[model samples]
Target: MGELKLMKGNEAVAEAAIRVGTDAYFGYPITPQSEIIEYLMAEKPHERTGMVVLQAESEVAAINMVYGAAGAGKKVMTSSSSPGISLKQEGISYMAGAELPCVLVNVVRGGPGLGTIQPSQADYFQSVKGGGHGDYKMIVLAPASVQEMYDFVETSYDLAFQYRTPVLILTDGVIGQMMEKVEVSEQKPRWTDEEIAKNTPWATFGKKKDRERNIITSLDLDSARMEQHNHHLMRKYEEIKEKEVRFEKINCEDADYLLVAYGSSARISQKAIDLCAEKGIKVGLLRPITLFPFPEKEINEMADKVKGILSVEMNAGQMVEDILLAVKGKVPVEHFGRMGGIIHSPQEVVEALEQKIIGG
Candidate 1:
C-alpha cells in the first residue's frame, strides 16, 4: 500500500494513470473532469516519469492523439465529459475497428446538448453500445466510489491490452467531484519492452530487425471482409461478457426485492437499502462494476427468488433495460431515476422501492 489520502475522483484517476505507466495523455478541459487535466499539468509527470500530457484544442483532436499513440503500441488515455465524449465517438469507433488498446475516461454530466455540469449517467448506452456510427463495443467499467476510480483504471488498462481494444471508465460528475479516502495500491503489473515487442506485432513502429511490415488500419474496403471483421468483434464481445462480468451482491442470499444500480446512483441507493431494512422489507443492492459486461446471469438468478427489481439510476432508464433483459419477464422490473442535473436522494430511492415492492 502506498498511503491513504483523500482525493477527488478525477484526481485519483489521473494519479492512477501515471502509476500505471501510461505513455501519453491527450484530452480537452471539461467541467467536473477538468481537475484531471489540471492535476496532470500541475504535477508535470514528464520530468519525473517520462509521460507525455497534451491538452488538445478539441475532444476530437485529443482522441485522435490517443489513436496515434495507441497505433504505436503505447499506453495512451483521454478524459472528458459527456458532450466532449460524444465528439470523440468517431475516434473511439476507429480505435475499435483497428483493434488498438487504450483507456478512455468519461466523467459524465447531464447530456443531450451542453446539458449541465451536474452528475448524470446519461452516457450509459453510449459507453456500452458504441455511440458512434458503427457496430462496436468498448469494455466499460463503472466506478461507484473514488477507490474504484483508482483501482479500476489499472484494471481497465490491463483489460484493454489483453483484448487489444479500448476500455472506458464510465463515471459521473458526482463521483468525479466527491472527495473520498482511497488507498493507492503499490503493486502494479510489469510489462517490459521486450514483452511488449513480443506481444504487439501489429504496432506501426519502424520494424526493427523483424521483416514483417505491420500496418495499423481500421479500413476494410472489401464488404465481405468487413462482415468478417464485425463477426470477430461480436465474438470478442461474447468472450468479454462471459469472462469479465463483475458485480457486488449485498444481502442477496435472502432478499425479497433486488435493487439494481451502478456508478454514483448506487452510492445513494445504499441509504435506501438501510431504510428498507428498518422496515423489514428485505432489499439487496446489485452494483455492476463492469457495466458493459453486466452480471446478467446473477441478475436472472436473483430475479427467480426475489419478488421484483427496482433499477435506481441517474439517467431516465438506461440500466433498467439491461435489468429487464436479465429478468426476461420472470418478475416485474421497475425504474426510478432522476436526470438533467438532478440526482435522486436516498429517501426518494427508498420511496421508489417501497412503492414498487410493497404497493405493487
Candidate 2:
C-alpha cells in the first residue's frame, strides 16, 4: 500500500503472497525461483499468519499439493522454473478440469530441456496455450519488473478466485534475478473460516458432519458429462476473453509501426521505443500483461492503423504467432529475439526496427 524499497522479483513475489493472505504454499526448489521457497521457509507464514507452507518432494508433488489444497477451498499457490513447470503439466490440467482456483508462478529459465539456468521467456506458448493436456486456459500474467512481480502475486490470486480457475505469473530470469524498488502492503487477512466453509463446498475435508459429501475429481466418465464439462470450460474461456485481457500501450495513436513484447523483453522494448522517437521514427509498443487471454482484439484494432508489427522477445518467436494472428494480413508482422538465456537489448531491437520498418 506504500512506496518503493529495493528488492528482488522473487522476494517481492514471496512477500506479496504472504501479504495477500495466501492460505497455503507448496513448492519445489528450482533455480532463480528457489528464493521464493527460501523466503517462505525463513519467514514462516504459519507462525506469523497461520498460513501453510511446505516444501514438496518434487515439482510434481508440489503441484498436486496445490490441487489438494485448492480442492479444499483454500487459497493456495506454488512456484517453479521452466523444467519444473513442465513437470506440473498433468496436475495443472486436472486443476483446470475441476475448476479449482490457485496461483502458480514460473520464474522461467532457458529451456527446451534443462536449457540453462539463465533467464528466458521461452515458455510463452506453454503458458498461453495450456501446457497440460486438454482444452483449458489459464490466466497468465507476465511481469516485466520486480514491482510488477509483486503486483501480480495479489492480482493473480484475485483472478483465480474470481474466475474459479488457476492463474499463472509468467516471469523470467532477468526479472527474477535482478533487484528493483518495490512497495508491499501491510498484511491483510484473506478469508474468514466462515467464508471458506460457506463458499467452498467442494473441498475434501470429509462430509461426516451433515455437509454433503463432495468428491473433487476431474474425470467425468460419462460422455454426456464430459461434454458438459467441456462446454462449461469453453464458456469460462469466452468470459475471460471478453473481460480478462490486459496490455500496456505506449504512444500507439500516432504510430506508423507497433512493437509487441512482454515480460522482461518488453522492458528493453520500451527503451527501443524512446530511441525510435529520437530518430524520427513513429513507433509504439504493446506490452501484454496477460499473456493468456492475449490482447488480441486490441492488436487487431491497431493493425488497421499501423503499417507493420514487430514482436520482440527473449525466445525466437513464440508470442509472435499470436501477434500475427491478431494482426493477420491487415499488416506486416515480424519477430526479433535471442534465446538460450540471452536477452535482446534496446539497441538490438532498434536496429531490427530500422531494417524491417524504417528502410528495408
Candidate 3:
C-alpha cells in the first residue's frame, strides 16, 4: 500500500504519470482537462525524472508528437477533451495502423462540436468503436474514481506495450474535476537505454550494426500487404477480447433487475443500486472497466439471471446498444440518460429503473 492523499482526478492522473516514469507527455490545453497539463508543468517532471512535458499549439500537433516519440520506443502520452480528441483522431488512426504503443487520455465533454465543458459519456461510441478511419481498435479503459484515474495510467502503458497497440483512458469531466482520496504507488524509474535497445528491436532509434533500420509507417502501397495487416490487427483485437474483459459485479447474487454503466455513470449507478435496495428492489449493478473488450460475457450471463436491465449513461444512449447486443432479447433492456452535460441524480436513476424496468 502507498500513502493516501486527497486530490482531484486530473491531478491524480498527472502525478501518476510521473510516478510511472512516463518518458514524455505532449498535450494541448482544453477546459475540464487543462488541469492535467497545468499540474504536469508545475511539477516539472523534466527536472525530477528527465521526463519531457510539452504543450503543443494544437491537439493535432500534440498527437503527432506522441506518434513520433512512441515510434522511437518511448512511453509517451497525451490528454484532451472531446473536441480536442476529435482533432487527434487522424494521428490516433495512424499510430494504430503502424502498430505503435502509446497512451491517450480523453476526459470527455458533451458534444457533436464544442458542446459543453461539463462531464459526459457521449464519446462512448467513438471510444469503443473505431473513432478514426480504418479497421483498428484501441484498448480503452474507463476510470470511475480518482484512484482509478491514477491507477489506469500504469495499466494503460502495460497493456499498450504488451500488445503493441494504442491505449485510451476514457473518463469524463466529473471524474476529472472531482476530488477524492487516492493511494498513489511508489515511483519507478524510467527504462534505461540498454533496456530500450534490448526490448524494442522494432523501434526506429537509429540503425545499429546488429539489425536493419526500423521503419514506422502506416502506408502500405501493396493491396495484399495492407489486407494482411488488417487481418493481423483483427486477430489481435480478438485476442484482447478473449483475455482482457474486465468488469465489477455488485449485489448480483439474487437480484431481479440489473443496472449497466461505466466510468462516472457507474459511480452514480452504485448509489442508485443502494437506493433501490432500500426500496426492496434487488437491483444489481455491472460496471465495465474496459470498454473496448467490453464485459459482454458477464453481461450476457446476468441477462439470463435478471428479469430486466437498465442502461444508465451521461450520453443520449450510446452504450445501451452494446448492452442490447449482449442481452440478445433474453431480457428487456432500457436506456436512461441525461445529455449535454446534464448529470442525473441517483434518485433520478432509481426512478427511471422503476418506470422502465421494474414497473414496466
**Order of models, best lDDT first:** 3, 2, 1
RMSD of each: 1.4, 1.3, 0.7
Model 1 TM-score is 0.97
Q: Write the per-residue lDDT of candidate 3 for residues 81-196, one digit (tens) a residue.
A: 99999999999999999999999999999897989998899999999999999989999999999999999999999999989999999999999999999999999999999888
TM per prediction:
0.97, 0.97, 0.99
Indicate the TM-score of model 2: 0.97
The whole-model lDDT of each prediction reads 0.90, 0.91, 0.94
TM-score of candidate 3 against the unseen true structure: 0.99
Best by lDDT: 3
Which stretches of model 2 miss by more than 4 angstroms? 1-3, 208-211
Report how far residue 43 has shifted in candidate 2, in Å.
Answer: 1.3
Tell how far residue 131 is off in model 3, in angstroms.
0.1
lDDT of 2 at 84: 97
Better of 2 and 3 by TM-score: 3
Model 3 lDDT vs. the true structure?
0.94
Better by lDDT, candidate 3 or 1: 3
Q: How far is candidate 3 from the true structure (C-alpha RMSD, Å)?
A: 0.7
Candidate 3 lDDT trough over 10 residues, lowest sum? 193-202
